[model samples]
Target: MSESLQTLQTGPSAAAPGDFGWHLGMVLRGYQFLFEEAVEGMPAGIRGYQILSTVLHRDPPNQQALGAHLAIDRTVLTYLLDALVDAGVVERVPAPSDRRARKIVATDNGREILAQYEERVATAESELLSGLKEPEADTLATLIARLAMDVHRSQPGSSPCEAMDHLP
Candidate 1:
């Protein structure tokens, strides 16, 4: 067939080790496993970490905006928030601009938890990039972040998250 098809059929070459997807998949899997272990006792695991970080760092979106941004369903986000609230990690506060709207905010305990785990998460991430040297890791991080932003900009609002249903 075509040259490109032939290349694809050959799989990873001896020198290349892996294609982009292979590398990305490996990193994703590694982080998921490591992060799970790191945040073992946290509610919702990785999702909980994401929620805590977002609420702590971002402008603190309301439930609807939070769900949309995170690609979590309204119902599911509601349940997650309930758990987070019960855990004393987050609280539902009235939006400043609109009292009718409720926004998610991290409690002092939540901020402390985020601070406590930040170093742990960083260490796990560093372990994932153990193959790279210090400079290489920094360069790779910069390049990957730039690439991610480019990809995001290229796709206005075509996130696969929109089409996919929340997994059980």
Candidate 2:
């Protein structure tokens, strides 16, 4: 028999398919797939939307900080920002405190698109969690955020985006 097929037949597998890390991975993948579809056709899809949202919600110190916070690499963030800057969705303006550093800010158009996308994405997320009761969903979100924050604190300087970096 083929090695791959043999492994699948004999290898350890999650007992419930909804247990532990495998279950988390499956859920996250589902959400990512749904979110990708949710943000389609809006300039670089989810990545661009995230960048725009970051700029809109927080005044990150500079491109580097934004990249770090988004868990995107500096080079990737630069490339992504190039399209956003060209499309006039965001601008890197010189920071008042530091001439060399530039802060990201969303333009009017970027904000508008982000607002629309936010509504759509929220609906998509709601639907994704539709199986859960409202309180369960809220508790889940809160717990997840708290867990992530704990991880961030424990693993200083690691990109949160790294969670999705290895997925197929």
Q: Residue-wise lDDT of candidate 1 within 18-94, one digit each (tens)?
A: 46666676676677788777887887767788788888777655877777666677888888899999999999999
- Identify the leading candidate in terms of TM-score: 2
CA lDDT of 11 in candidate 1? 50
lDDT accuracy of residue 38 in candidate 2: 85
Off by over 4 Å in 2: 1-18
Error of 2 at 21 (Å): 0.3
Tens-digit lDDT string for candidate 2 (3-116): 765665664661532355776888898898889988988887789999998887887888878888888888888889999998889988998779898888899999898999
After superposition, the stretches of candidate 1 with alpha carbons farther than 4 Å from their true spots are 1-18, 156-168
Clash list (residue pairs), candidate 1: none
Compute the lDDT of residue 105 as modeled in candidate 1. 92
How close to the true structure is residue 48 of candidate 1, measured as C-alpha lDDT?
Answer: 83
